[model samples]
Target: MGIVGYFLPMLICAAIPVQSLSRNAETALCQTQEMQGLCALSGKWRNQLQSEITITCKKGTIQGLYDSTVGNGAYDLVGKYLQVNETDYIVGWSVAYKNQHRDARSTASWTGVFYAAEDIIKTQWIRAAFKNPEDYWSTFTTNQDTFSRVQSHPCLHNNRN
Candidate 1:
């Protein structure tokens, strides 16, 4: 057999494990276990301000949120602000994919927020901005198209029982 016939399948199989390991590492890194007590908004929340958010936090849970509107709902613990008109907390999270291969385009970022009592998770795409480099808020872009690059990005968990 020629090189193509002998190594083609082998090369494909070898790619699988490497991909799986990379995804596993990402999931583990994103889990809230590492954050522990840092997740202050462990309760649900409602928005009272004119802003476009209705967030709810799962009790003792720290899950990420993704919103399509409002800078793709990009937020940072120290930079983003949430105003609650009702009882509870505002929970927000983000996901990003960095491409190691020069051939593939990198995704901007995915951000989301949860409205506790409503049990709603909104997801949106955002591109990184450089207006106010020092402030986290300035780095947010409300563009949903940025998600295409990371749509194939794997999730840490499987809902399949």
Candidate 2:
């Protein structure tokens, strides 16, 4: 191919700043995660622990409700839906159990991803128990869970259980 032909693509990319490219990518991600579309990452999901969470994704934010059978009850959740690059979409969220005083804070936090191919969210988390104001040691436990969508993705309508 001619040199102009080879450099045309490069020239086109160079015309757009790197920051602009990043913003465009984020916008595209939001489009896919919009509420109206059923492509992925917006639904009711349940884990093996019988914990159910209803997730909603939009504009790089994740908002939902989580209910744990073993915990007090249901709670509101807020998190991020991040696209670090072309191949990575990371999900992180927090459910705070208590917050009455400076040292009286308890929470469970999670970080994971939604696998588009299998439509499952595999995550690792830490559940931290509140400690006394002057305590040096804190009590916490770690665990992992795989969350499956309550309803199948549209593309896998009749193919998945």
Q: Rate the local accuracy (lDDT) of all candidates.
A: 0.33, 0.62
> What would the per-residue lDDT of candidate 1 be over residues 9-76, giving only the tens digit for each residue?
32232223325547556445335333222222322222222222212122333333322243334222
Per-residue lDDT over 40-112 for candidate 2, one digit per residue giving the tens place of the 0 to 100 score:
4655789998898776554576666677877666666668877655544688899886423233356888999
Q: How well does model 1 score by local distance difference test?
A: 0.33
Q: Which segments of model 2 are wrong by more than 4 Å? A: 1-39, 84-88, 98-105, 133-136, 152-161
Q: How high is each candidate's TM-score? A: 0.25, 0.62
Given candidate 1, what's the lDDT at residue 59? 30
Of the candidates shown, which would achieve the greatest TM-score relative to the real structure?
Answer: 2
The RMSD of every model to the true structure, in order and in angstroms, is 15.0, 14.2
